[model samples]
Target: MKLVRYRPAAGEAAMPGLIDGAGRLRDLSGHIPDLAGEALGRAAVERLAALDVESLPPVPGQARLAPPVAGTRNFIAVGLNYRDHARETGMAVPAEPVLFSKAAGALAGPYDDVVIPEGATQVDWELELAVVIGERVHRADEAEAARAVAGYCICNDVSERHWQMGGTGQWLKGKSAPTFGPLGPWLVTPDEVGDVSALAMSLTLNGEVMQQSSTAEMIFPPVFLISYISRFMTLEPGDVVTTGTPAGVGMAHGRYLRPGDAMRLDIEGLGHQRQVVR
Candidate 1:
């Protein structure tokens, strides 16, 4: 099932909803308090799928979409996990997964404006598959990690090359500006999404394709990343773990974003996103 957090119209509050088999959205706002938590329990997907969508109110076609999940306490990220991206950045493929954190404030809706900071000259785009954790786990195993996953969504790990490389070399400062992490079109459950690792991912600057690669190229897939990360920190409900992007970022080609640049991103099965630099 594909789920969303949306506001029905201007100034209306956002709430959780399910995109049914026919593509219409049914509000699930009151029924499930914490979908991430519910999705982790035994027979969870089956139970959620069993909800009577027909009885729920239909969401307006023009509803403003929010990132599918909210209250993301830990916005974790993996770096250089794709071989081609690592090569383009001229960084060695890490022997183990590379981890980093982005401030939770960076999260934004799929179609929201991507603000270009003042005096910023090197903003960039990164297309990645972001995993939304469904349950809490401390030092989870592979099988446990797989079950703990709530779903997947499209994420643009927007970056600023200047701050990323300029600092003491830490990535968070450059990565966590508000609206940098634009996520969702919807959250697609694992059961509904087949072969998560082989999905195609692409990002286009305006109308030109800038980054295009498959998740198949990931050096460390979602399951492994989850397991590895759990060993170091606790993974909790509603937390987001964004896998690294592939090659063709603006920084690699010296093609940074401009005030009027438009970005379009798509991930197979998951969905697409549109953003414009402000």
Candidate 2:
């Protein structure tokens, strides 16, 4: 099932929802509080999947979407996890996953405007596959880590390269800007997603293809990354770990985003996201 969090109108509280078989949005608010915390666990998700989708009230007209999962305490990220991405930057592939964190506040609706931080130069895009953890786990094995996943979604790991590489070189500074993390269209379950490794993903800037690759290119896939991360920090339900982006970032071609530039990111099965740079 495709779960979502959305607002019926501006200033309204976000309500839990799902996309039914007919591709219509149906309300799940009565069944759950929000799509976060324990609601993201495997057993909880399975219970939700059993509900009669058609009987739920339809969310009329267009509602503004929020990131699929909420109450995320840790918004972790992997860097140089994609081989082509590493190559494009002339950086050596790390034997282990290079991890970083994006402030949870940076999360935004998929179609929200990506405000270019003031005085920022070298604003860029990194289209990534985001994983939402379903249960608390630490020191998990690959199989256990795999089972801990609740769902997947698309994430735009928008960046400010100058802050990322300049000064003391703290990656979080460049990655944690407001509106920097645009996620979701839906939080698709694992059963529906099938083979996560084979999904095709890409990003287009102003209608032109900029990044294109498959999860198959990832050096440390989701399960491995999850397990690796668990060895250090305990991952909780609703926590998000964004697997790194593919090649073709703006930095490689000196084509950073400017005001009015639009980005559309697509990950197979997870759905797509559109954001206008402002």
Candidate 3:
């Protein structure tokens, strides 16, 4: 099911809805008591399935979208996990998963404007597969790690090369600008999406393709990534983990985004996103 958070053009309120046949959206929040935990689990989905979608309220075409998940505590990310991306930076392959965090406030809807920090010259885009944890997990094994996953979503790990590499080597400092993390058109559950690694991911700037690669190329796959990160930190419900991006970022080519540029990103099975540079 394509779960979304949206508000009609005439209203500013946000609520959950499920994308239905014929592109119409049906309200899910009122139908499902809880969007988190078991309410989002398989049993709850079965309960939702028995209901008549036509009975639910219809969402307006002019609705403004919000990121699929809200109130998430941590937004964790991996860096240089792709062989090609690592080679582009001339950095050695990482010995372990390179972990980083983006402030929760950095979260923004998929189609929102990506702010070009004033006097910032090295802005770039990294299309990644973001994993949304559904259940609370701590020190989980691979099997448990997979079980803890709620769903998957797409994320543009927007970065500033100058801020990322020019000053401190800390990637978070360069990554955590406001509205930097644009996530979701939907958050799809595992039942709907069969295999995560089989997905293809790509990024286009101003209508030109820049990055294209498969999640199959990822060095640390989602299961391992979840297990690796859980060893040190608890994976709470709604906490997000963005797997690394593939090669062909603008920064690697010394071509950065300008005020009028637009970026469109898609992760197969997950959905697509559009962001305009401002």
Would you estimate the TM-scores of all the predictions? Answer: 0.95, 0.99, 0.93
Instruction: Point out where model 1 deviates above 4 Å.
Output: 34-45
lDDT of 3 by residue, 11-65 (tens): 5767778778677777887775435555655466567767788898886577777
Give Cα distance to truth, residue 197, candidate 2, Å.
Answer: 0.6
Please report the candidate that would top TM-score against the real structure.
2
Candidate 1 per-residue C-alpha lDDT over 80-121 given as tens digits, one digit per residue, 9 for 90 to 100? 999999999999999999899999999999999999877677
RMSD of each: 1.6, 0.8, 1.9
Sort by lDDT, best first: what order? 2, 1, 3
- TM-score for candidate 1, please give it: 0.95
Model 2, span 2-24: residue lDDT tens: 99999999988889999998889
